[model samples]
Target: MAVPGHKLDRMFNPEVVAVVGDKGPGYMWLRNNLPFKEKGGRLYSVQLDEKEIPGIEALGIQNFKSMADIPEPIDYALVAVPRQVSPYVLKDLIANKANGAGFFTSGFAETGEELGVKLQTQLTEMAREASFNLVGPNCMGLYLPKVGVRFNADAPVADDGKIGFLSQSGTHGIMFSLVSAANGMHVSRCASFGNAVVLDVSDYLEYLMLDDETEVIGMYVEGVKNGRRFFETLREACKRKPVIVWKGGQTEAGARATMSHTGSLAAPQAVWDGMMRQCGAITTNNLDETIDVMKLLLNAKRPTGTGMALLAQTGGQSVSITDAFSKAGLRVPRFSDGTYTELGEFFNIVGGSFQNPLDMAGTIQGSMDTLDRILRILDADPNVDAMAMELSAMFAARQWKGKPETLDKTIEEIALHKERSKKPFLVILHPAHEAEYVASIQPKFHAANIPLFQSFERAAAAFARVLGGGGRARTRTGVVGLALETQPR
Candidate 1:
């Protein structure tokens, strides 16, 4: 999907950005770590220091003593000034007609103090009065790679992709986005709206629904001001695109953490679950599930049913995978008689069972050609809705091929069959400590858009998530833009 030309221009593609106050480590990191200097926009250091800010002048970053001193109009104002003077800097930004402001300074309502609350309320009123979109009073605002808008220098710089994420926690936002990018789901945009004194979770959720670049929206939400509005927006969004939500706080202790972390009042787990079910939104418990879901949702083809075909390198592993699939609410139907007969023609079926979770140890040991043929048959089988290959190469003594060319050919064959099948194909590389070895060959699977997991249980769990979400309602054929009228200024 293509990004909306207008919204992209205004929100993300800020041609001129002003950073106010002492350029601390965060500000310096953002300035120093910008991925592209000659691309979309320019960043300026706004501070009292008249002396040149080091290393910025060469990278298209200009220095201005104040926002007023800068003659050119600023698209966005990043407030990192001292707490007492932040209000004044914001006033100057408004006077200069800046379209948006992202306050990275803390000491807002999160402190749970009357003064903090008053300060946050004051900032919110200022934004409303000036008709400018406020990101947060105490948060890392935007991390958009397309326009070089990033808050953390250490975060991954991924080429813009389909996933769009929002979080109420700054650290979680950075962590999840980086994790998602490394796992092949490149995030188009990510916002950490801490305290949410101005634009809340609902606003971002609604915005992402219209973002043309966003095919899937993932959120790490602590709380919301208006539950009904949040759920309503979520339900409408789910109808158009997939919305994956991870509610942060469920227990009393966790609720306290949410309150302290973002000054949010987290709802009960039961209430949150009911709301998610009613809205048809996918739910996640922790960060691992969040990443797992995104990896599969972005890459795997949507399935119409839950009939899974499991193939493992060993019989015991196959049994474990079959059990996991069954527990995950997926069907492991017995292959039709024709399928059994077809398989018998390919291999000596003396010891191998022809049912679901077919053990391919003998076929793999015998010939890569036979294993490739079996995969093609399973891929074309109408009874199989999804295919899973659980492998423990460390446990197997058989070598499928001694040369790189032969192995590449085999991988190519498996990839082609998986592609033609138009269903989720999960490859489980087991043994947690042997992940490094698995990682070496993981790219072969990822290159074909197949999901690779560390365990049989995780593979089945991800498949179950895909089935629960119903996947994207429509195939993304073209860019889907959000209506311009409702877009934030």
Candidate 2:
């Protein structure tokens, strides 16, 4: 009994929400729903406890003795009662015809106990028979920022974001939203569906694939109950938009941990990797890589080929940049004869080299005009599909000590050039032990729609993934470029 898309839609953008069994210890679930209340969604509490009723009401939220007592229908409900008492509350929700519900109670099948397993089975039977949209028996569920629905109180409420995320772990889901938001990326919708007994990963994947608001989809999966269905949905999703997957339990030890964590049976590392590659989907190892890859896909221009042009401020940096990109399966080829001849006209050879990985060590530090000319030359080169520049945080700070306006103007000019150029441009700003200084300047790059990486390795890896996955660019209507013509490998 699969839940219909319209029901899921109403659940996601619930006009009325309720919290069942929220207590005073932390009042966590009730507090988590404050975002919905603040955003003009009607919120009610379904609590029978006499002592906790006043505290909940003190927060100005209307409290009802039961779901039936609520004046209106509930689009979504958060159930946080004790595990033993969950079935009763769920029955009440179903009797009231709530659209969907997410259970915060643990000690379900993941506990591996007879009682826990029986309880989960009972709830699954009930949900399936009634066609209820049960999100999770043990997970934080649904962070829809546009509608101000959140699992964590601190999650951002900005609506203008492009990333859609789905995860099996609540911690990863919450962390992804907060971390991505902090990095100037926002999630259109996020679901941490734990022990997905009723609504599984495939359900959400299908929903997001057609979501107009989501441009890119990110997944953090431990495993799936139906492999064929999940991959079918994933393959179709990749065809529509870029799908980045971070498989959690690739190792034996980690796989064992996942069974208890989400009662998932993770696939072998080789099988998972091969499947993702065959689906034309990008793969990442951890949270950082996932975010980095999404940032590149959303912000950077799509590379027509794998040829990269590297620029560095120091000789050592030039060597490292070339090595990093090359090792990541991208080529740092030589420039065309015409490109080299053009550079020879003004490129200072006394302290710099005019090759593919152009070493501008002592040449363009004093002249922004010279740097601009170099960028133009590279941008015009036929062999260069993409360009990357490496700068030290300390160098930037020292160079623009009192001329902050100059730095701003330079960044603006670079952004403009990127727009005009046919190739994609990336920047690698090394912290160089000046992390705070680097962080302070990142917002400028973000504001200018420039993708900035903290290291050459990260930038190169993310770029390689984007190119290797498919050279496609997502537009408001759909995907564009050769990516659509190519079949999954």
Candidate 3:
């Protein structure tokens, strides 16, 4: 039976959450619940062991001997008991009528042992009979920042994040949330539904599609139980919100690995690819590409066309930038005749070239006013649909030796130009060896909402995907999909 929408809502944004079987060694799940408590939500610890009670109490959480002992209803419960003990705990949760429960216990069907399969079947039948909302028999469930719920203690939480993510692997879920957050993209909600025996991926997809807080949806999946329902929900979701899917187990070896990992039947590669294309959903290979694509979809303004204007600090960088963007299916075309006339007036040709991929080696030696003029010329060029600039930390550190304020002012001018210009603007800040220099300017560009990449290749690949209609779907009449309409920026 499908869980009610209201019940799932309570589970994601629970007012009262309980952590069962949390012990003294690490107090792992107990520590995970501290964020919820810090956000003013009620937290209770269900530990029958007298040895564990003191540890739970020391953390300032109320300890209960059993679920029945709790005075109020539980919106969500995290169970981490042994496999044999889980059935007993499920009875308690079912009787308590908890809105939702996630089992962190392993040794279920994924074990492929007779006892493991039997235990999983037993739990699945019991939950279905009672119409209970179970997240996973082996998973690190929900991470809703608005409710201060998180699987990892260090995971960031903010009320204004717009990215929603779902993963079949707990490790991917944790890493994706952290990586995306570090790159200025915060997650509104993230779920790591492992061995999804009850509530599957499609259920979460439908909910996230309708969620007002979630503007873009990203998923990491091993496989699905119901292929028809999964793709059907995906098709509908792509119409309402941009869905980026990172499917695991495309190869034969990977397919075998996924079965052991999640007890999922991995789909054939050809079928998976065809269905994703038919649904108009975006596909990614690895975690880095997934984050890169999501960053562009959430941050960059959609380019009118794939035409790009590249700028770099050196001649070698200019050549590499042109090759990278061009190879990624984006055009680095020549400037219009009028644009060349305007640049010829002040752009020095002795140390710089003012062609398509402008080598601005000499331009940066001039004042910020001069650099701003070059940017304005490119922004007004009809041949340029988008612009990408390579900012070299080594060059900036050498040229501005002690004038740090000048570098800051130059960045601000570029940001202002991007804000008012019609073209999408991007920055590639390279060579992490100069961490101090890159660190100083990263926040300034991020605050101004400019998409910053560490390499030209990464920026080019992400930009090409965005320009190829990877994020937005168009209707027969040529109108933007609902996802684009509802998306902010």
TM-score of each: 0.89, 0.94, 0.93
What candidate 1 gets wrong by more than 4 Å, as runs, is 1-9, 22-27, 50-60, 366-368, 395-407, 431-433, 471-489
Clashing pairs in 3: none
In angstroms, give how far residue 132 of model 1 lies from its true place: 1.5
**Residue 64 Cα positional deviation in candidate 2, in Å, after optimal superposition:** 0.9
lDDT of 1 by residue, 1-489 (tens): 334554334666577777776454345634633564557566667767644465345555777776788877777667776666777877888888777777888887778888877887788888788877788877888877776677777666666578889998888888987777667667788888888876788888887888888899999998887766776788788987888888888789998998878888877677777667667788888888888787778777776788999997767777898999899899999887778889877664566666787987776664667777787788778888888886665653124224556546656766666677687777777755555655666677666666768777777887788688645343331211111112111
Residues 200-225 of candidate 3 have per-residue lDDT tens digits of 89888988888888999999998887
What are the per-residue Cα lDDT tens digits for candidate 2 across 1-489? 113455588787789999999999678888887878998999999888999998998888999997889988889998988988988988988898898899988998888999989899888888988899998989997888987888998998987878989999999999999989877889998998999989988898988888888899998998877776776777789999999999998899999998899888777777677667667889998999998898788777887788999999877888999999999999999999999999999787787898979888577865778888899989888898999998777677776557788678778877888788878899899888778877887888888878889999999999988888754432232222112222110
Q: For each candidate, how many residue pairs have backbone atoms clashing (under 3 Å)?
A: 0, 0, 0
* Lowest summed lDDT window (length 10), candidate 1: 480-489
The model with the greater lDDT, 2 or 3, is: 2
| Candidates sorted by lDDT, best first | 2, 3, 1
Task: Output the TM-score of candidate 2.
Answer: 0.94
lDDT of each: 0.73, 0.85, 0.83
